[model samples]
Target chain A: MDKETTIYDIAKELSISPTTVSRGLNDHPAVNKKTRQRIYEAATLMGYRSNTFASSLRKQRTNTIGVIVPMLNSNFQSSVLAGMERVANEAGYNLIISQSLETVQKEIANAKTMFDNRVDGLLVSIAYDTENVDHFEPFFSRGIPLLFYDRVPEHKKCTSIVIDNIQAAYKATAHLIEQGCRNLVHISGSLKVNLYQERLKGFKYALMDNNISFSDACVISTNLSVEAGISAAQQILQMDPMPDGIFVSNDTCAVSCLKTLSQAGISIPNDVAIVGFNNDPITRIVEPNLTSINYPGEEMGEMAVRSLINYLDGASDVAITNTITLRSELVVRASSTRKGEAS
Target chain B: MDKETTIYDIAKELSISPTTVSRGLNDHPAVNKKTRQRIYEAATLMGYRSNTFASSLRKQRTNTIGVIVPMLNSNFQSSVLAGMERVANEAGYNLIISQSLETVQKEIANAKTMFDNRVDGLLVSIAYDTENVDHFEPFFSRGIPLLFYDRVPEHKKCTSIVIDNIQAAYKATAHLIEQGCRNLVHISGSLKVNLYQERLKGFKYALMDNNISFSDACVISTNLSVEAGISAAQQILQMDPMPDGIFVSNDTCAVSCLKTLSQAGISIPNDVAIVGFNNDPITRIVEPNLTSINYPGEEMGEMAVRSLINYLDGASDVAITNTITLRSELVVRASSTRKGEAS
Candidate 1:
């Protein structure tokens, strides 16, 4: 925060004129490379910081990007943020991040703030239930590059980065069937989200493909929180014949369900098998390591920032690209294996 | 990213000079409130934004604060961020956050970037291995307010927000002792950080208070990651008689150790009462809920930002107030109670 060292300081240190130091630093043909190197060295030694505002006034670029995420507390979201941070930092861009706390109102406020700050581009992973995107009109009107990652909305002008949730879900459900589960249940998030809707579709399709009845009653919709997991397990316990297999949309809920069932004297993989999504670290620490879909959260984050920067630098036109899908794999563990099958 | 609207547009629409419009926006005593509200409404309609740089030319203050953390992927750090964001946003100040990724080199680079960005105030939670504070000379020289939270360094000019880690650890260790744990083992992170160091001291004091001689062999230093928990369990299993009690610095590692020990046929509570820190949601979902310290991460964040803003606005001086300690408590649960004493 101290006063930025000016070219005069550099010249004074080197016994030269301010003009020569500025020209040298700017790489003018008139100044030799040796002189430029000397000027740069002196500037660095004096802790001289380039006047970003003066340069921004002339070049109209800040070399900074803005990012808005729902929250940074979750393992998946944090992985994504770490990925974005690495790519942005390596590319000589700083990331200014804010969380919306899963509210549309807060998301709008964050968008307005980001706009007022004059960020060159934006990367966003939207809140839980964002019904309208009119708040982003200013960015669209100005043609500023905008990209979305996980929890994306259906927007044509904006590019999206995500994994194929449907395919991952299908593989997870099919793994349950391969373990000899005839009756299975899928615990889904709110149907409003495209991720959950697609995952539910995959679950139903897998059941149908195996000549099993895909009943609407088999799917349980909840917030997918740990408490929701406990409630889901309670509901399962009350059934005439408990579910033989369970696939949850997230790990937090699955862990809670597994704990509750174990407490009620239910045998895992023998009487019931379980699968969860996101491959969160908790999946491995549970009593029976949970089988789950390995979401590429970090990779998705890295890709989102990399793509946005590429578009900003004219290395690529991401707007023409609709969706970038990353790979997701099914990780089989003890929770969902009845036959002790190798994965 | 678009051309910013200025007071000139508002003045042109209202048939007034640009100077009068600007003065009205600044709430000049000469301008009536009705005229000021008119200008504000017109500015809003015209999509006008206040230029902090132009205003700072007269006021010498920027309505922006910078935050640097070691990483964004931890439960504690994210909770702190949520609290900071709520306070900073409510005060109409923007926060530019960056991660150090637990390296001193990255910390220095992040500090330089924050300085270059002309942040009005800075909040830092120093990296694990930052041996020197020279990187912060720029902020210190200019009388900029610098505050530290959580993993703070021993700096005179900076104010820090933290909990009594020693007391929290003492309490946790005392609880384990009360549960009849004689030979106790403390699983700790590297002793580089003050929190870990203080917690180790408290653990030693608890053992001494209980007439148990502290042995260096009972302490295991680790990265405190989930992988560390697995390896630590292997080491513990090789002990002469295996410690009767285990206390871990973090819940993630504690839960992993519990699972690994259980797999090795060691029953929790009955065999080894376990205690962990940071009452994360995982504590409840584990077979026997983990006993942990409920550290006030959100409150700590809010307090740090609030104090920084207070210092910036001349409402408080961080130089005089060196440290602010928040409350922390041990929440006893099933994991550390074999004889129902915790109840």
Candidate 2:
């Protein structure tokens, strides 16, 4: 690395006071326009870059937002991040992102790193295993605004942005039943996650509304990965009475499971109707295109950053808004439209 | 925002000199262990988060790497970022990312932000219209290591990690020819980008080798988006002598084109054989299973970061390794196999 040129170096080279150089670089009103121009030219000639770290020490503002996500390799998360980036960038804020790889220990470590970096605010979609958020105490105690999206924790000090998972799930389940499904199975992610737990509730409620008795065998909890989908399919195949319908937590798993069941000679929507959450692109390509919930990932992300920035800039009181629910809708596709209906 | 606690606040509360508090905070050996413990406890009570900005001012190191990508909403780029995060986290470094939105202006703005942040190193996949890299002069002049991947510019001061686009394209084109394709259409991205230009060259070379007549109309330079695929398919349908095969730059575009063609009563492999680059998950899900080049995005990302870190740490001279080419393979699937061969 090359030696960084400080304001002092510019001052010494230009025969000016270090204070004047610093003031000029900062565009202080006290500095003369001509003198500032000279300082800038000299600094540019020396390749003197502004040390944001040093400037932030005096200003107590970094103009950087910290973002911690569950994983980066997902369509939903990527869409959310793209939305966050658009809002944050337009507002002249940089986003520093970290992934927890679905573990609490890593989440804590990531939170610590964000705290150490002194990010102005934090946006988090916490890991699946992050049962509690004692690690985020520093942000609360120090009055750093934190907003959670998608997968969130309930806290008085934080604002959460999410879609109504239960309503979406209920719609999906009821749609499957309307398509002539009798016995149904719901493939869920870790029930520890609020979204999955709420989805489980919706599935039960839908069954009850249809006068069908639900049992423990109706729910299959897994990690909600592509591989998990295959195993869940195998488990479903071994059941005493086969499920006529299946609803999965994510499209990746749903698509995989659908393929496996089809390879086993099961006709989609004839033998089994399927519904998946998160209308990812994979849903469109899969044969008998999977029915899915249109999770508002991008909107949720925009709301998270906008709320945090609002709180930071005193434009609005994010504290009063405990949770902001974005709209989610069921996208009925070929996978669930059984009775000779077009997708 | 709340008031931040400082060492001076601790000193005043504990009735000790500010120097003692500062030393204790730094874990200085000169400070007594008992006083250090007391200071630590008091600091915790007061939410005295360490100001890394101030510390970095003295240390002249931030342990942060800046990454600039074309787009975040891409399957290939997401996989790359996942790999980058894994390697950077293990190396005890933080990643700050920005997207160019496939524009040179945004790319320039992102570069300035990274420079102002004083990142230890930078990794960039240049934007679509990035004709020259004069905007990257600040990093170049400051001698901060800059590494490019996938999309790159010819820069003497930088290292690039990329796959052999020409070889991958050649293999794809040759495979289609082997399957009895008389005339082929190449759906390419902006020719301004080196990768697309190389692929175009490969496409032309394969046609010349097969003794087939080619025209400028045979090549379609597009944005390579899903919408672009539909438009390209329309163009193909209007050709005087319809091309028997197609090779698209990305899978998203390829799948859309295939869907459009199929909906228009065009048969796959029989009417048109197709191949795509970036063997994304969508390739497998699409009907007839798109044939594509397995571009090693994760490996490229890992190699880019590893080289930049190696350069920053003085472990290796990335300058000597101007360009590092990772392995790429043509995964022949049903889309391009017209000779009744299995995938």
Candidate 3:
């Protein structure tokens, strides 16, 4: 391997003092613009790296933000990541990203790695089964900024960004009821997650307000995968009375369920109205155009990054803010619109 | 901020030599398992973080890999990232990720950031408008391993992992021809990319082999966006004799085109049989389940990271191999299956 070029090497080549070269490289106003440009060209030509390692040690900042997501491939998470990358990049910070794969153990491991790496701040959307925020205690002790988005923990010290899942679900369930759906079922994810638990609450509240009875049999707890949706549809088929309305937690599962039920000779809206969460592109591609909650995934991501950066820059104290709630809306489509209902 | 704990602090706390503390932290065999466990517990109690900054400077390895993609929110790119993350995480490396936003300028800026961060290795999927590989010249000059996947550049010095786009396109087009289609149109992305250019070649070759003359008018260049697909469908509707078969470059655009055509009173697989590439989940959700080429995005990502890591680990020389091609298969479904045709 070749030896790395240092500012001292550029100083010698440019016949300038090492301090002048360092100042020029750092763009300290002490050096003129022309001299800085000359120093930059020399550095580029000599393959001189700016030595982020040394600078990070001196400044006690890595200029890197750590992001731990539940999964990387999902539509909502990916959109959130895109928004985060845009904000972090524009702020001259790099993102160190990892997925927990929906396990608390992996999330703990990922959090430890981010801490060991000395990331300036962290943005996390925790795993599905994470019951506690104890793993992040080290960050709080060190006074590192930790902000959670989407699936967040109920921690007073840590700030969070999220949409009102309960309101979104209530709107979806109400729309289905207004479409003349009598017996309704809610296909939910793990109840351990607060997001899904709140959604279940919304479902029950909507039913109670509409003079309909809610039962444990009406809720199906699933991982909310495509296969889970197919199985849930099979379960729906075996019901004696049958469900006239269905509110699924996500679009991926809902689309698969819709397809399976349609193949089984179920007429959409006319026989069974359906509503899904997360207005993913799949919602539109699916037949009948699924009604869903626009969860504002990208906006949540952007807000998370912006808040963490602001706290880090001392422009704002996110710790005092506790939580930031973004707006979410229910988009009604043909899937939940019966013959007499407006889409 | 409080001062960071050091090995000396741990040594003093445990009544041991700093050298012994370092060996225990590094898990050297000289330190017994019991002593190592004690050292770990003490280090944890004192909130001692391993100084990766100083260690990286001494070893010239950051234990980090940089990844640059055209966009972060796309289904294909996210899947690739998930695969990469799985492999890299198991290998004990962090990923610094960024998006180029489909511009050469942004790609260049991302490459420079990765370089400045002194990443041990880099994985890139070039932007749509990137015409040259000059931005990566710094990595090549420094002898740092750089690998490309999916939308790769034609550079001899860099290794790339990709699917055979030409063969995949040939299979898709040939399937449409076998379904008894005479007239055909190909939806394509920017020809500047080698991947799209090769697909165009395969589309032309398939027509030539089927005794169907190819013409410039048969190709509609697009960004492969949903809006572009709708506009392309409008253009197709205005043709003198509308195309009987269509092969789109990606599922996102193809599914949109299919929906637009379906809404315009055109029957799928009867008026115009359609085939798309990158068998994304959306393909299954679309009406008349889209026939597509199953591009292995996750596998491609895994291969790219594995190859680069292998090269970095001195286990194998990826540069000697140049390119690794993964297999892609054509999945025939209702969208491209005409009456009496086996799907």
Candidate 4:
């Protein structure tokens, strides 16, 4: 690395007092405009960096926001991050991002790193097996604003931004039932997550409301992935009476199931109906299209960042808002429209 | 906001000398273990931050890296960032990321933000239409390590880690020609980027090597979006004699062309062979599957971060290795296999 240009270098090169150069660089009004301009030009030529760390130290604010997510490659997470980058950039805050890779240990490590970095705020979406957030105690104790979005856990001192997963799932399941599905199956992600747990509750509630008795056997709890979807389809085929309908927590998995079933000569919406969550672009391209829950990932991200920045700028109070729920709707496409009827 | 706890707070709470408490916090040799423990407990109870920022100001190293990318929502870029976060976290450095959204103006703002933040190093993938890199002059002049990957520009002082786009495009085009494609059309992104420009050059070279005359009209320069692919397909249909082969720069656009052509009753491979760059998951999910260039996004990401960190650690000189190119291959699938060859 090149040696950093010090105030002494700027002072010597510009033939100005070191104190004057320092004051000019710090934007002290006592420095004359012409002298300040000369100092600034010399500083630019020497590639002098502003001493922000010193100011941040004095103010006890890092001017940085930490973001932790389950993984970085998913479409939902990516869209959310794009929105976050926009809001955080506009608010003059840098976003330090880390991925948990869906592991609790990694999440803990990310939390520690973020805390160690002295971030002014933190935004998190918990990983699959993250049962507790003991690692974030430092941030909480320091009174740094902590916010959670998407796969969030219920905790005090943490404001959460999420859509009503239960209602969305309930509407999806009810739509499948309305499509004349006699026996239905719900392919879900790990039940440890609040989103999946609430979604499962909604699925059961929908089934019960339609005079259908639900059992633990009907729920296939797995890591919602493409391979898992194929395996779920194989499991459905082996049943004594094949499931007439299937609803997966995510579109990637659901599209895999649709493909696998189609390859097995089971016609979509004719012999079986399917509904997926997260209205990802894959839903539109998949054969027969897919019915899914239109998750507002970008909107949720925008809200989360906007709220965090607003609180930081003293424009709003985030303490009073414990949880902010966004709107989500079921997008019924051809995949679940069995019997040529609206579901 | 809660008031930040200071050394005075810990001293007052523990009824100890402020100097002694500060010494304990700084791990001074004079401070005994028992006294240090007492200071630590009081500090924790009072929510005392370590004030590393102050220490860093004196040391002149912030231990932070800045990263700039064209877009954050793409699968390839996300995988790259995931790999980067892993390496940076283990190295005890934080990554402050920003997206240019493929605009030069945003790229300039992101650079200014990174500069103002006083990051230790920078990693960038140049945005579309970013013909000049005046925005990065501060980092360049300061001798800070500026590493580029993927859509990088030609710069002497910077190290670029990228796959050979020309070679990859050559392989893809050759595969189509081998499958009995006489006339070919290369659907590519803007020529403003070196990557797309190289790919286009390779396509023309492949045509020349295959004894087919390359025409200016055969090359369709576009944004390489799904919408662009639809227009490309429409243009192809209007041709006097529709091209017998098509190779698109990215998968989303390739899939779009495939869908549009299929809807127009043009059978893939049999009527017009199609190939795509970037073997994204969508390639496998698309009907008949897409033959594509197997670009190693994860490996490229890992290499980029590893090189940058190595340069920072003094293990390697980036100037000595101006450009590091990774390998890319053609993954032949049903989309370009007219002879019924399996992938």
Candidate 5:
């Protein structure tokens, strides 16, 4: 019920014209410093705030970026969001965030909302069932800068920021081989996602490089959830000959599988080596200290925003850069380190 | 750059007046259903998204809520955000979120930005060192419908959604005492936060009720991080007679302490019993599953947004209802179960 303070009110209070008040507030060279100080003091006393909405309409920029993630509760996504918030806030841009909840329908709806809201730019990690990029066609046709991170689509117009998942997964698998694990199993997510598909490629490539036979049975496609880990462990328990090495797509699932396997009387590293992606805190907390790929979630998030902001500000043209890949490395731990193993 | 498609473009494309297109788009009864369909088709063809800025200026509403949390990377905060997002999306409201990074200065700056952006309402979980509510006074004065969850401030105008921390802590401490623990230690966070202060009170009250002498020496104030847990364990080890029961304020710290103590040759439940708050997933993964309080972070988040939105929509008067307490319970596990104890 209270009215918003406007330049007109400040002008009336200071006995100056509204034009003079606006110029003074905007720090125009036409306005003297002494008058500007008096105007600022009056404006503060009256609780005057510049109307961002009206100004945004005139400038055709909202100074806000929209971020769409598959889900927000995951450790990796949250870390990425933290990084985005840090960078965006420092750049004086607000982030309007939404979750697709891993559903393509919801992803489409979220995209529509973000587009209608007129965000200056958008950063997205597509949903699990996002079969196509048709939903984002409006952004592309309108020439609104769009960037994808982590789970990206193969779009020539949009730049993608991601870790080299194929390389990361290869390192994880190769480390298991070095630990004397011959019979290997890879716990993968939905291969429909490019990242998961690339990881699967990495797994097969590693097996081929090591002269190990590759079969479809060696890869178990799962949602990569905690419960999925337990279920995967049960499935492994029923295998003709249990796997000597396991590489999971994520830390949560890997840790869960390790615990379930340990509970089932399987010894870690000695009998089976395990490697997980994402160097989450739980990797260290889990017994034997899980060997994991340091995914650099925060850095990826920072880079995505920085690239998009730079492109928007014309400081850099991210459009020409197809993909920005951050470095990822395997962190050797007891989980994948066997003593007296074959060279 | 491509220009935005306006109602005029749709009207011109459809060979109709702009007024007819606008009314059809708004679904005015004066416009026939056939005309509305034609307007929708033309709008889609032209990519005519509703100008939210200009419309919001007329309605004095942005349909966006601002949320400020201490940090975005924490498990609990992420879960809370997921809940908020689900509810807000269903209600057709957007969430512009930011993190204070546990600094009051950042919190103040975030609030100012939110105010300038004209979010319809605000939900806040205060930072570690936020001692006063002065930063949020503008929202309070503007009748903008502000609510706080978890680490809330003591404000009359704002309704807070939180679990009863004192009761939850009392339950945890009482569970430890019932397991035949006389020497008890409580690891807490900064007392500046009301939630932490209340937990300390509960710990002391539980000791008093059990006829055990309470001492300030029995309490350890920490940042409650994983590293802090290790430091607390070292501090406990140095005590002349180590405590028999330990209740940590959160799962991350408690699990860390439990692991450190176990590595130091202390047998859990037999040598010392431990209880943690916020039954995080790590509680189950720890060697001996940790006993913890189920804090219901998602429920808290949902409740906070529901209350704020209800008040904003005139469905409820949240201001009259000062505090909304959700249920929190002790989840007993292997960490605190002493076999054949005195009880």
Candidate 6:
């Protein structure tokens, strides 16, 4: 790499003080317009870059946000990242994102990286088996705004943004019951994940409310991959009394299970009514158009960044706001709607 | 924010020279093991963070790789990013990523930000309408390793990692023809992108080889979005003589078009054989299962970063290799197998 041009060099070339060159570079009103224009032209001609890293070090704020996600390939996580990137970029902040690949060890490494980088704030969606969040104490002690979004840990200091997973799950279960499903099955993610655990609670509560009692065999815990969905479907097929309703915690898994059952000659919404979370694009393309919960991934992403930025700008105190819940609703589609009066 | 502890503070507390403190932190041979262990303990107790910012400025290398993509919400892009993150993180380099959002303006802004941040190298996948390469002049002038992948610009100084799109497209088209299709329609992304243009060339060449003269009517230039797929399907339905084959540049659009056509009572393969690019997970869930080209997105990402890092480490010269093409294969499935024996 070539040695970069400095403000002092530009000042020397223009026969002016270095302070004047710095002021002109910053577009300070104290520097005359003509002098600022001359400095800009010189900077461009000389390939001079006003180093954001050095200036950020001096100012004690990098104006960059660090985001650690469980995975980058998921529909909901990517959507959230897209929205966060939009808001952060619009606010003149760069986002440094890393995927933990669903490992708490990797999450710890990523948190340490963000701390070493001196990011203004940090946003995280914990890994699947992240039992403790002590790795984030450095950021907390340094008074850097730290916030969590989906799949959050139970932390007092961090503000968490999430949809009402319990309510959404309850609505999905209630709808399946309304569709005349007597025996229902739930395909859940890891019980360690707060969201999935809450959804399980909702599922059990809904069954109790509907005067139905189910055994452990009715619920299958999975990593929610497509292959897992296939295996879950195979397990359901082996049940003496097949499940009439299925609620999956993710769209990819639900679609996979639905396809597997359909391939085995089961009529959707007749033999089985299914509901999934995260209204991913796959829901519409699948046969019978899957019913799903409209998890606002984009909104949740934007809100996370907006909150962090607000706290950074002193416009709001994110510390006082312990938990932030975004509204989510159930979307009823043909896959879960059994009683149709018109058709 | 609380005042960050520096090595100088540790030195003062340990009653040691600043040089000894720095040497101990680096685990120098001169600074014995016991001293290093004590230094580490003190550093941990005082929350002393190594100043990567100042050291990076002195070294003129940030250990950060900047990446610019057109979007962050796509399956292929996310997979590519995942691969890039894995490689970069393993190599002790951080990736600073930004999205162009399919616009030249945002790309230019992102480029400037990367330049100002003094990233060690840059990886870019150009936007839809980025006709000029002047915005990236700083990287070129400064001897920063610049690599482009997937959607790239025609720049001699930059190394581009991509699959052979022309061959992939030719295979898709020839497969459709072999499935007994006479009239064909292609759903393509913006031609401003080099990959899409090369695919178009392949499509044209395939038609000519099959003794079919093509026209503009045979191509549907679209953003390849779901809505565009629906509109394209409407256009195909209105043809006086419908096309017997369809090729879409992306799986998302292809699946959407297939679903729309199926909903309109068009029997796939028998009526119109379809082939799509990028064998995303969605390809398998669609009713007939999609026929697609397996583009090596993960490999492409790893190759881009590997090339940049090799150049940085003086292990290889990337500028000498202008283009590195990865292998892609055709995945023929139910969607394009009309005369098949159900195998």
CA-based DockQ, model 1: 0.52
- Number of clashing residue pairs in every model? 0, 0, 0, 0, 0, 0
lDDT of 3: 0.92
Q: How well is each residue in B218-283 modelled by candidate 3, as lDDT tens digits?
A: 999999999999999999999989999999999999999999999999999899999999999988
Report the Cα lDDT for residue B81, model 2.
91
TM-score of each prediction? 0.93, 0.91, 0.97, 0.93, 0.97, 0.96
* Winner by lDDT: 3
Q: Summarize candidate 6's per-residue lDDT along A36-133 as a digit string, tens digits.
A: 99999888888999978777877898888999999887778889999999999899998888889999999999998888888899999999989988
DockQ of each: 0.52, 0.65, 0.84, 0.62, 0.86, 0.79
Query: What lDDT does candidate 3 reach at residue B270?
Result: 97
**Pick by lDDT: 2 or 6, better one:** 6
Error of 2 at B88 (Å): 1.6
Predicted structure 3, TM vs. truth: 0.97
Residue ranges of candidate 4 with Cα displaced over 4 Å: A1-43, A339-343, B1-50
Which candidate tops DockQ?
5
Residue-by-residue lDDT tens digits, candidate 3, A1-343: 5788988999999999999999998889999999999999999998898888888889999999999999998999999999999999999999999999999999999999999999999999989889899989888888899999989888778788998888888999999998899899999999999999999999999999999999999999999999999999999999988899999999989988998999999999788899999999998888899999998988888888999899999999877898899999998888989865545
Better of 5 and 6 by lDDT: 5
lDDT of 2 by residue, B276-325 (tens): 99999998888889999998878877877888888878899877898899
lDDT (tens digit, per residue) of candidate 1 on B1-343: 5577888889999998898899998899889889999998898777776775556545656577888889877788888887888899889887777889999999999898888777789999999898768899877777788888888787677678889999999999999999999999999998988889999999999999989999899899998898999999999999988899999999989988988898899999899889999998778767778999999999998998899898887898888988999999999999999888664
Candidate 3 residue pairs that clash: none
Q: Candidate 4 or 5, higher lDDT?
A: 5
- RMSD for each model, in Å, please? 2.8, 3.3, 1.5, 3.1, 2.0, 1.9
The C-alpha lDDT values of all candidates are 0.87, 0.89, 0.92, 0.88, 0.92, 0.90
Superposed by TM-score, candidate 4 places the C-alpha of residue B43 at a distance from the truth, in angstroms, of 6.9
- Local accuracy of candidate 5 as per-residue lDDT tens digits, B141-214: 78888899999988767688889999999999999999989999999999888999999999999999999999
Candidate 3: stretches off by over 4 Å: A339-343, B339-343
lDDT of 1 at A69: 88
